[model samples]
Target: MQQHNDTIDSAASADEPDQIHEPRLWRDKGWTARVIKNEDGEGWAVEMIRDGSAEPALVGPWTMGRNKVDPKPLDATAHQTLVKTASEVIRRHEQQLHAQLNKEVSIDFGDDVVSVRLTITPDEFEPFGTLIALNPLGDVLATTNVRPDFRLTRESAGRWAADGFGKIR
Candidate 1:
């Protein structure tokens, strides 16, 4: 916990809006990159931290220094690269979460077509989803709880619509 707090503090210090320094592996705006010895003591690892975050956003192997034992020193280019990589990692994770939590499909509803959405709420204790049917005007026609892993496939949506948007068996 102290290590986490220290990391957050380091990130916050580096992220001060007015501060600017030559690129280095240590810290950048709202982010910090630090290299540490691996647990096994056989290799080095780098940790990327975001300001105000109690956990590292990314962690990966680090290159050996000239001593062939110590970790390489952080530099401007390496810091920038690590920041970009960490940002991309965050972006991809968010995209994946969005994809898993929200899904929609169009289906024929009698004379008109409507849309159905399955939005999962991933709770560690009680995972669930809300299967919602929307009319042409975007008004919700129905809503019901479903398994957290429910998928909004075309066949399932069509069947649900046909069944008056109750259960998507």
Candidate 2:
């Protein structure tokens, strides 16, 4: 009987919206900072969670409260710091992914040098890549559909250019 009553109480609470301890420190749009108790029983830890994201974008140590016994409350200065750090983390991740998906190589074709690029477009339904050739003046010469994992190498680019931008064997 006790277990059944407890389950009913939890189910009722689950229907209610999330109740934050301090409403002023959190925002519905953009990113929000929350100060939580550390599991190590030491100090506090801050988590910066972006709106619509399931997990926190960044989490790190936080300062202690004035009495040095409890976790410090969230403040404007601390929230700003967390937002800056989380933004940098997201920026670096985007740059690394772009570098991995986009590749470029230069190959000598007789007297002129040609630039070959392989760009991968990752889509949930159908992922594909585009193999493009550009002249010295950065003008597109040819384009072809390629495998998403295509690699642009000097030998491969040379063969593609020599064959007039046909499918690579």
lDDT at 23 for candidate 2?
Answer: 26
| Model 2: colliding residue pairs | none
How many clashes (backbone N, Cα, C below 3 Å) per candidate?
A: 1, 0
Candidate 1 on 1-169: residue-level lDDT in tens?
9999999978976668643443224766668887877776688998888877888888999998888977788886888898899889999999998987899998888887888888898899999999888899999999888988776788988877777777654
Model 2, position 131, has a per-residue lDDT of 90
Model 2: worst 10 consecutive residues (lDDT sum): 19-28
Model 2 quality (TM-score): 0.75
- lDDT for 165 in candidate 1 is 77
- Once fitted onto the true fold, the runs of candidate 1 whose alpha carbons sit more than 4 angstroms away are 1-25, 167-169
Question: Relative to the true structure, how large is the alpha-carbon lDDT of every model?
Answer: 0.82, 0.80
**Whole-model lDDT, candidate 2?**
0.80
lDDT tens per residue, model 2, 1-169: 9999999968865764452336235432367888777777777778888878889888788778789977777665666677789989989989999998899999998888999999999988889889999999999989998888777899989989889888764
Query: Largest TM-score belongs to which candidate?
Result: 2
Overall local distance difference test of candidate 1: 0.82
